[model samples]
Target: MFNPKLHAWLERYFYQPGYFEIVISTLLLPFSLIYYCLVWVKFKLAKPVKFSIPIISVGNLILGGSGKTPLTKAIFNEFSNKYKIFIILRGYKRESKGMQIVALNGVIKCDVATSGDEAMEYAISLKNANVIVSNDRKIAIDKAISLGANLVILDDGFGKADIYKLNILLHPAKEPRLNFTIPSGVYRYPKSFYNLADITLKSSDIIKENSIIKPTDKMVLVSGIANPSRLSFIYDRCVGYEHFGDHHKFSKFECESILKKYNADSLLVTQKDYVKIKDFGLKLSILELKTTILPNLIDKIDMFIKSYQISDRIYSNSQKGDLC
Candidate 1:
């Protein structure tokens, strides 16, 4: 059981810069050296698979929540019916051995605890769309194609040497894009990794302009996410906030704590945080961010896809149905 305080301290050091940080980073060089070597070997042996379908990856260098799921949802919304959209995840935190296909009809079901929290969130959010989780992304893409999917969206996959073409990198808003290694900071790789990006972007501006919640209402901001600050920025003037871990499971005691902690007319939440406490038995007025992208996002993404190599099914969005 990791305490919230330790998580907070790690998150603080994860972003802050100091002499100790420099020294630790220096010590961590050997690990990076090993990672780089593996990358090199993987690069040498890895054969870029050319799929009949166009595989577009939306990812980040950070270790956890950088809003990639929201962006993926945005992309899917943009092209779901317009094109046959299939989403693939690496299944980061999930627990199964073999690959699995998640099908949620009226009930919400997922493999998040094993597949990873982010992947689970994506599975739930895009319930209407086809979501698959597999370790080998290329294998997942192949499976999607077999299932009649024309376009596959690689959720949170980048620098993945195995998948080629149409790489879009996600950067956090507050964090400066630099060469900080993992465990020390959110970055999974170095700043040089940005070189692989076709479109480099910050999540802050995107969230401010597009999140669904309105600023006029008095609401309690409840968060159990990796980057609470980003969500805080969106709900700055909210009456109160109850913070939790990245994937915290709220006990009955904690739910009671929330009820005792704040006095507000309603509650506001990020999609990530919303899922955790939704069934908490507290009938507070709840609000959620409508996942979407900035204006002209569709046009830009479409034009970029046209330049890539994909099959005819890629453009066949003529299906007379919504995301289902």
Candidate 2:
């Protein structure tokens, strides 16, 4: 299949949805329906395995850019002091991964290639929580429990049925209220599964307000993420942009070309994109947009922890301090 061209079509189809998408997505709707049905049956046939510790999942039905990563950090921030926590991700598009450890107590060991961009971002972002990369989440979670994690959080794990967890689906503010299944649209799960979410959250709830937003005379928005538009705020002053496929590994030549193509004096990227290329040693000035997981959601999560008896140890008075 023509993957790149299809991806471009999808971007327009999902975000703009004019006559082009109306016709294209309609023709592709049957395929999306079949895929969704197959997935639904797969989940139904699989048995959910419960870990010795609680596994909380932060995910979304939409394809990407729903703020699941920041929300995961938010949950991590809430319980890191009290629980032995670890994050499990599929290490999407990573070179090496069969249950690799990325971080321990906030210290990262592996390069971004061993751990995908999102996992590496978590490793760099969280100073205390451990991050693990594996396509088979069961192996990762089992490893986490063995490594003394009382809680294992799965990132982008909405489709994994092997382990049951607290399902938190994030809805981005900019995302349309309703969405369709993939191929035709960005929704991976049918909208009917909306009721499956234990709690539905708005991405705006976690988006940091004072996000880095200094405008420049000439800026090139550089990113390789599922939903690059989430960083649209950076475009307010952007002269041009270059978006590689999600989790794309950047080469020195590519970075240099992006600079030349846009004739950009400075380069701007999201934290997720920054981790992948921070070591590329590019010459241009790079600015990163930071995301903060607000504190309001913590109250609801804390209550769930207590209700389910997940843990009693919250941050002590001395530890009770800041929000990320």
Candidate 3:
């Protein structure tokens, strides 16, 4: 339901300020205050849920396309072998309303319509983990634990004070890191709000510089994501783009139409967008670009996981005698 044009407009207001934008931003400033108040009320009223399992949250302040999806997938790849992981999605725009476990032990049992785009991507790619979709974080984790998930990775759960966990907030590589309320800007919270996170970083800190063509190459960058412009790294070229709305479903015709219009040498796509493409049967020679976390970041994350795991064990072991 998010309009791509409005998304572009917001990006300019938040990160790319000019004379006209400044005047517009000033007009929207009053609305931003109201937006901020609503956010505070929502979180304040939200019930905080706690789980014994370690939670690693990868989220963004600038809304979707902050590259959190790739980051979440990367972190899951790193820790899946050691932990029975569950990635929780809100199942945005799905017909269903409750939690559904789409994958378990590397087997996918649900389709994209039920699990939403991001959840389906995880269910499809990360065979070793479970993907559960639910708005209620507590219920999702409860189901996760019941299904043998020892760790829960929250998708888009930054400042979701409902659950006490390790939160990593993502900023785009080139974004000036604007923190305004929705309607006025992409950020739901203020700039100072990132301090609430365990780690505040750019996607560059963890993203792998995956192989791609130079900026001079004539490639067509095609995407249907919340933040299509965030793919700027791949756009370091004479790249023509075909962007769609957030969670936009691409038809087979649309896919072919784009390729025909651009007539570029190579095609580029996001992992999330690729799933939809496959479903639509638009199989072009596409370069799949995914960002990955850095090695040092892995170590830092591992340490946090270990610290939580160790304390959990100590508490579990200590409580044994008390139960007896």
Candidate 4:
């Protein structure tokens, strides 16, 4: 199978309807279709949880860069004070053996490593909010419930037929929309899966004003994300942008090489890149891009919480009785 990141590029290129990309997706489309069907069936069979608090899922039918984390934080910011909110992430790339609550001082920490970049980012971005990571989301959701979360949010969960309501789906606002699928394309679930979404969002729209900072001199655009283009678009205006893979664990040597090749004096990276680069203790100066989730979406999200308050009370009481 092609790397998911490479597949994202392939899908974008294939959407151009040229011979090379079309022939590639055509050859691979049969297998991609079979896999999609099998996964679709499995998704249907997966057990779902009925939560007391409304669970909003910010996810993508596609594999990467649907902007789940930014949406999660945006929704949380809207209602954190009005209701206790909890975020559950799948915690990709963590070394932890199994599902565990992210903790520091016996509570969740804002550390970007164990909690996944976006999870930690959101945890820290939202004051007094709970962030939990679990491969088994049911367990994670239960933990959040026990922690007195009145609303639970899942990041990067779309096709999973587990507990999700009020689905907020994000589509990347790049040049191509539906250009790819699995091995040859970036989509994880078929575009039909997007039908499950209650609201459709575009990550490109999240930033109203271009907040990209101008580079002082030569710089390299460092990223460890599925779609480096999103960051690249911002940096293209500033200086030359060099791209890398999603969740790339860059070594000290690699960083040095990138610096040397580009004559780059500084590094601009996504939040996900920050965690790995910090651990490496690289000498490059880093600037992070901030994503702003729009306010109207936040208002609608708040309304959703306010409507679910009574149901949350009953669910909390039921869980207490079961524990007793």
Candidate 5:
């Protein structure tokens, strides 16, 4: 179902559009308008269900590569000591279906195939929190509550208008030249939707530190993530680069072949990609990128949690009185 060429074309069309891309985008304007209307209706008709537990949603307006996972990890690290935290996601490209518990109370319960790359990354990286992947977010939240989670962090949850929570929207360092939706461009939601978020953060708001251990002077960069161009910071140092579709499962043979093709001593990859191939017994150098939330953002999150704990009105789908 994943076409690498199509993916690459869309990326260029969305972010670095020239005259041809602009004309194509213009032709797709009607579809974008229709998509916008449908989303607007969905939000208007949404009856978001809220629970007694505090929920923090980190999401973005763009389609992908907005640093939601990193931000979620940062938030988990900040609050995991205080509350029984649960991180929930849709498990974008997992092989399994239904609600899957990737990790529970610091113990990993599933493998990469079952948990997907991002969820598995969370399970392996954050030990104190639970990680769950499910298409039905309401069911996932209920499961987390039953498992004694006092706080929940939803990854890429902005579109779930049916869930009432403190919304934090992330913006990429550089937005697309054309802000069209879906086929026309990469924006999942209109830029105006940013105003609805409880806190909207730019890429500059967070600090990133990149480090590589056992580094090679020139290595081949092999990555499977959205917006690979964002790695421009490390481009000058790499001898070669090979990009795959976001969350593409890499095989031992493929990795070895890539290394040979570039004639490089090692393959450089992101942390998210590392979890999948760690057991492959291949030569790898990880591009360890750590993200930290600013103090002001942390203070805002604390305030939201405090206010949520004391609030009496529980958001619900029904017009009846609030539950609990």
Candidate 6:
């Protein structure tokens, strides 16, 4: 199902467009237009269901990763002390079905295969929050509520207009040259849709602290994530690099063969990739990238939480017939 060459081609076609790329994008415009109309209709017909607990959604307009997981972790860190936080997402490319609890109160409950890489990442990173994965987000939210979650954070949840949430959209640092929807380009929605978000942020809004301790001079880099070129800083230092489709599960043989083929002493991988290969008993240097939300953005999030709490209290009182 996952073709590495096709993925690479799509990435280039979407982001770095030359003459041929532009012509291909032009040919695909009709399909993109149809995709756009479907999305518009979905939004218009959506009757978003409001939940009792406050929900914060971190999402992006692009097809691939836009640092949503790190942003979600940052938010969880900020509010975990005050509320019983639960992180919910549609476990992309997992083997399991129905709702699965990846972690509970910092303890991992399931393996990567059941939880997926992103959910497993949350499970391992956030010590105080619960992590759940399900195809149906509403079902996941209900499960979180039952587990006594005072607040919910939804990963990649912007598309779900059926659920009421404080929408936080991340704008990628590198905008696509073509800027068309699927089949033509990477954008799931147009740039104009940014106005609908409660709070919109850019890659610059978050701070990244890279931790590479005693790094090898010319190791081989093996990564399975969207936009591998985003790590060009590290890639620049590597002797060679092998990129797989996003969330590609690597076998021990594949890893060993890569290292042997490159004739490299050390291997480099991202934190997300590390979780999967950690049990293989292979020596690896992880690129631990710690991200934190800017102070102004934290303040904005606080304000939204306060407003939501106030409105929720008023609605509760009205339901109880306490206000006449």
The alpha-carbon RMSD values of the candidates against the true structure, listed in the order shown, are 6.4, 7.0, 3.4, 4.3, 3.3, 1.8
Model 4 error, position 107 (Å): 6.2
Off by over 4 Å in 5: 1-8, 312-324
Better of 3 and 6 by lDDT: 6
Q: Write the per-residue lDDT of candidate 1 for residues 41-119, one digit (tens) a residue.
A: 7656867777777778888877767777778888887787766777788765456755667533213345445545555
**Which 10 consecutive positions of candidate 3 have the poorest summed lDDT?**
207-216
Q: After superposition, how far is residue 203 of candidate 2 from its true place, in Å?
A: 3.4
The TM-scores, one per candidate, come to 0.78, 0.84, 0.85, 0.80, 0.93, 0.94
User: Which candidate wins on TM-score?
Assistant: 6
Q: What are the Cα lDDT values of the candidates?
A: 0.66, 0.76, 0.75, 0.67, 0.88, 0.88
Q: Which lDDT tens digits does candidate 2 get at residues 150-235?
A: 88889988788767788888775667522668888778888777687877877456555434444457778887877665666667
Name the lDDT value of residue 149 in candidate 5.
Answer: 93
Q: Any idea what lDDT model 3 has?
A: 0.75
| Candidate 5 lDDT, 1-324, residue by residue in tens | 456688778777988998998999999999999999998899889999987788899999987788888899999999888899999999998999999999998899989999999999999888665999999999999999999998999999999999999999998878888877876888889888999899999978999888985678768898999878778788778889988878989999999999899898888999899999899888788898789999999999999888887663433333345443
In candidate 6, which residue ranges exceed 4 Å CA deviation? 1-5, 213-218, 322-324
Residue 151, candidate 6: Cα error in Å is: 0.9
Q: Please write out the lDDT profile of model 4 over residues 1-324, one tens digit for every residue.
A: 226566565655534546676677678878888888888887788787677668888887666676676667667776776777778888887666466666422365535556666565555446676778888888887788787877888887665587757788887665353444676566777777767677888754587433434344666777677666566456653355656656665777887777777777767665556656766655544554445677677777767777777667777899999999
Q: Give the C-alpha lDDT of model 2.
A: 0.76
Misplaced by over 4 Å in model 1 are: 2-4, 95-97, 104-117, 176-178, 183-185, 203-207, 210-220, 234-239, 263-267, 284-287, 290-300, 309-324
Which residue pairs collide, candidate 1?
Answer: 61-188, 93-114, 93-115, 93-116, 94-114, 94-115, 94-116, 95-114
lDDT of 3 by residue, 174-222 (tens): 5553456765666766666777788877745765556442322566888
